[model samples]
Target chain A: MSALDALQATLADEHAALYTYGVLGARTSQSATPALYDALTAAYRRHRSRRDQLRLLVQEAGGQPVAAAAAYELDGRLLRSAQVQAEALELEVAAVERLLALVAQSSGTVREWALTEATWSATWQVELGGAAGTWPGAPELA
Target chain B: MPGRPLSRRTTLGSALAAPLALAACDIDPPPRESESSPATPPPPEDSALVAAVVAALVRAQSVLDAAAAAVPSLADRLGPVRTAHAEHLEVLVGAVPEADLPTAGAVSVPAQILPALGAVRRSEQRLQREVREGCLAAASGDLARVLGSIAASTSQHSAALATEVTS
Candidate 1:
């Protein structure tokens, strides 16, 4: 994939991530589950910032950024705090995959940015109560 | 579900094709390139980059091993991080020739458990930075992807170690 295409693809994933986190944030009660609420809120904001950055990157690369879908299908019901955290973990894992692709398709400053973002995404997985895998983004190694 | 698109599969397939091929092979010595061979070989610096990362992993593994030995109580916590570095070393060792591989030097652990754990955490953070730099400097996208993944995994290790030290 071209660098621009990779950026757009990552942007699309960020959009879905933001939407999912928004849903999760709504379900989490700050008084009852303060930690989970904060994590979800932090994730939502991070994804939003990433989405905007991708838009600028796409434009600078001489391509029109892909638009976010109106809605995306959630993987599972977010009824419980555990369920909400699990869903957020899933999103971050998926984000790591997308950012790894971006690293693979781009070079120089773009690749550096993707690497930093992928590291943060992987760290977020642990913050969300997931195991730290030997290979965070490269599942083929696993 | 917001399923990943097919393009990601294609991208990863193309990007990882080289390293995955290397990973699948036995640890046989790589065949020397002949004048008649038409295949484009990776730049010399790529090999150097991989070798440097392999050395870093070896050092990190040694540090973890020493820390675990000094503090039996924290072995369970240090086990996964050690395993991760070992696995990373195995994969990267395939990328460089046997002759170019670096040996693991002696590493010492502090007598106190907390200080030993703190030392291990610093080692992981240093390894993480080295791998991240290697990822950024890699010439081949395949190498960059692999290094980037390792960097991410190392960062998680560092974070876990920090949490363990404080908690």
Candidate 2:
């Protein structure tokens, strides 16, 4: 896929991730919800920077960027404070992994850019460990 | 370094790599066809109960797996829990009925993870509650000996989960 396509993919994911986090942050009922909110916002911020870089790359490649979605569907059960948080975290991990796949699919200078950005996004997970559940040394855990 | 895949795909360029990819999927070695499927076998209620007991262990393992994923702060504590479940599975598999030969299944990592202790702790507690209850239900039945064993495991799991949740 083209760099523009990869960027668009990442942006789409960003749009979804931000929404998930927003819902979770707003609705979560725990005393420590503040911590979750902080981590989510930080992740959103990092995603935004990448989105900007990808947008420029997309324009350079003569592709229009994908538009962000206004809202997302949440599993009804996740409406609860705890479930929402887990659900949002799930979305982030999925989005990150999917974009990484797009990076692997890319070529040329676009490939380097995508890969570099992918690593950066993934590294952020150290603060928020992987959704992969109890494997080994997971990074980017929040 | 930790995120690296256990067996990464080399990507031999599609066509040439297809064979290797297939090989890497851990396809089971060829199986000799059983002379015939066992039928009208004895109640093996004992074995059935044992299988359920074992399934309970796997259920617990799955729960611990999820707990570990959702909250990484308890990773150290979760390790022993995982071992306990694994050993439980091993024992149950050993005792399962002939009709219920063990089936190999996939063990996937939970797709959502948060390393921060607060988030991790909450998620783990929730999932721990789920597994503790599930394992107990799975093991409790007319097969008291087998079911009883699983109940015991669940009790241990419940104790651990409760400690974490209340704390």
Candidate 3:
């Protein structure tokens, strides 16, 4: 994939993440599940910032930024806190995969940025009550 | 996922360079052009970066082992971290030819559980930084991808360790 294509792919994934997190946040109650609520809120904001950054990166690379879909498919029941956390973890893992591709396709500052983002997403996997896998972004290695 | 175009070439070159680089570590010999075929040039820089990362991983594993031994109660918690390091080392070693790579230096762990966990966490954080730097410095995109994933995994280890230290 070209660097621009990788950026667009990541941007698209961020859009799905933002949409899913927004729904997850709504399902979470601050009073009943303060920790999950806070985690979702933080993830939502981070994805937003990353979306914006990716848009700029795509433009800088002389490509049009990919548009976010109107809606994304969600699986399983998200009514429970555990379910919500699981969904968020799944999204974060997907984000890491895209960011890893960006790291491989790009170079210099862009690659550095992708690597940093991938690291954060990997940590988020653990924070969301997921296993800290041997390989976070590279599934082949795992 | 689609594979990178250069991945095959890079992997082959890295596999070939691994044993030579590990062997050079003991002798500290100069780079030898004749050692590699002209079609597959020796990746001296990548080899060096890989060696450095491998060394760091060895040190991190030793520290975790020492910490686990010092605090038997924390052995269960440290087990997964040690496993992760072992798996990482295995994958890295798989990239190179079979040779005696550098071993870990002596690591002293604190007797106190919390302090010992802190030491392990610090080692992980340092390894994460080094691996991240190596990812950026890597010549091959394939190697960079591997290093990037390793760096991410190391960061997760560091974060997990931090949580353990505090809680």
Best candidate according to DockQ:
1
Please give the TM-score that candidate 1 achieves against the real structure. Answer: 0.87
User: Which is better, 1 or 3, measured by lDDT?
Assistant: 3
DockQ scores for all the models shown?
0.44, 0.01, 0.30
The DockQ-based order of candidates, best leading, equals: 1, 3, 2
Candidate 2's error at B6, in angstroms? 16
TM-score of 2: 0.41
Order of candidate numbers by TM-score, starting with the best: 1, 3, 2
Poorest stretch of ten by lDDT in candidate 2 chain A = A133-142
User: DockQ score of candidate 2?
Assistant: 0.01
Looking only at chain A, give the TM-score of model 1 against the true structure: 0.97
Per-residue lDDT over A94-130 for candidate 1, one digit per residue giving the tens place of the 0 to 100 score: 8988898788667667778888889999998888988
| TM-score for chain B of all predictions | 0.74, 0.43, 0.76
lDDT values, one for every candidate: 0.77, 0.44, 0.78
**Residue pairs in collision within model 1:** none
